[model samples]
Target: MKFDCLIVDDEMELAETTCEYFNLFDVHTAFVTSAEACREFLREHEVSLLLLDINLGGTSGFQLCKELRLTTSIPILFISARSSEDDVLIALDIGGDDYIHKPYTLRVLLAKVKAVLKRWSNEPIPEEDGGLLQAGPVQIDTKLRRATLNGEPLKLKTMEYKLLHYLVQHKNRVIPKEELFSGVWGDIFAGDGTLNVHIRHLREKIEVSPKEPQLICTVWGIGYAFEGE
Candidate 1:
């Protein structure tokens, strides 16, 4: 069977409640209690997105995310009670699409999930000016939501694509962190760690050397600039 979303968390009560609430509003949601069950469920069903918790019956969600990323590109949103910047950074670094702090309101979670699903299921934005945007050896096809480095396809997640596209659109300018957050996430209150991690991931994909990135350069006390060709 196919589901729009799958909730994988050991907090059985919360997971079940969330699943029920989502289904009440036609989200077509399901819940599982452990990583083992999640794996088995995936084997038997098709899920468009995942709401995964960090701790799952002695198995880390980080490890599961790493394993799943090898086989899937579905969006993974980590839901946990841990709210430290390091936790958020680690979640994004480990292939998570977004990190939502626990003790969450159901309404907010539903809004976020719906927004992600809407984005996930849509085709790429059509370029208003048309054609590919080139930066050094990299190419971004806005119409296809595809990016390539040295003529080879780059596997970028949703946030990565949005960040890169925004940076390229404002190339040669040092965009403020606040501006980037507002522009990409539609939330000016987004944490710096979130932006920093996405920038690091973008560097890994588009730069010849992520350690010393020439394409996306840090502006010291300011923000980032895309020095494109």
Candidate 2:
């Protein structure tokens, strides 16, 4: 079975409530109360996105996310009461696409989920020209929505691909953080930490020395510029 979203939360009441809310909005949703249950559910079902809680009984969502990333590129949004910056950073660092704090309004959560679903959908973005964008050693096939570094395929998450494509499209120009948030994430509310983590991830993939990135250069307080010859 295919589900639009799955809530993997040990808080059964909250998970079921959120699931009901999503289903009310026509987002076919399901819930599992433990990390083991989530794993089992995934084995038998296809889920487009995950609303995962950090504290999942015996196993942490962070561990599950790390395990999932090893095989799947599906979007994972962390939903937790832990609001510390470190928690958020760790979530994004380990393959969680976005973090949502607890006590979140249902309407807002729904909007965020829909936006992610839209971005991660199979529908390709409208291509420019022949849709092949090159930046130094990196080449992006926009139509196929994949990128390669030195002719080798890059294992980029959905947001990483979008961010890289946006940077390459405007190569040599220093794009401000605000512009990146609006253009790539399509969310003005996206934090700087999220952008920073993704930028670092991209640099690690395309730059020979991530510490001193040549392809994606940081402009300090400004933004980033993709300088491709």
Candidate 3:
């Protein structure tokens, strides 16, 4: 079955063009003009991925992304005119999988969509928090979407689980925030503060004191690393 996708954008021409391109490539694509419409589509249909515009008829993609995270963990790719570094970081922080600038090649976009769909919807849905991914007192169960500190269950948002999962999967090394954003959320625009918020949340859940985190440690101004002793 073809993976379903939704594009939320105010630019009708661009949205239609993208939808047409995806359809041509056999990725079931639907286009909408606002977050509200996207919301409706999500409820009535099954969408494997989302192409969200940061500015949709003056609506904030960041806010929409935050809302989407609360419901489904489906992949979200952002398309916007904003090219600022901070904007990109905020996109990632809010749970968007990737960011795309205007004037992008439709071919590249299609390739990215296929890759994301394949990864997030990998064959054989992993069991809830499937298997234990452990590091010191911290544990990540991908299938269950849960993390643990010592023996206690650590409350983790969908994005937090993904961020930590990516960090643990590449443990013992200091990874750049951009790379983490791209890899964990998908290679897209991630806002600067997004990772910080999730990291703080993760630390609060795992670290005895977030001020002195022992597991997910910072690599100065670079990014983060999962330290296992």
Error of 2 at 17 (Å): 2.3
Query: Candidate 3 versus the native: TM-score?
Result: 0.72
**Candidate 2 at 191: error in angstroms?**
3.0
Tens-digit lDDT track for model 2 on 114-201? 8778767746666985989997988999888989988999998778899999999899999999999878877665668789899988
lDDT tens per residue, model 1, 151-210: 999998878888888888788899999888767865544567778899988898778899
Worst 10 contiguous positions by lDDT, candidate 3: 121-130
Angstrom error of the Cα, residue 59, model 1: value is 1.4
Which segments of candidate 2 are over 4 A away from where they belong? 143-155, 186-189, 219-222
| Model 3 misplaced stretches (Cα beyond 4 Å) | 1-3, 123-133, 141-145, 169-204, 208-214, 217-224
**Each candidate's TM vs. the true structure?**
0.80, 0.85, 0.72
- State the lDDT at 134 in candidate 1: 79
The best candidate by TM-score is 2
Candidate 3 C-alpha lDDT tens digits along 1-229 = 3348999999999999999999998999989999899888888888899999988777898999999888888888888888987887788767776677887899888887887776676543244334767777777776666777777887676667778777776778899988986777564545455567678778877777899987788888898989884
Output candidate 2 Cα RMSD.
2.5
- RMSD to the true structure for each prediction, in A, is 3.2, 2.5, 4.3
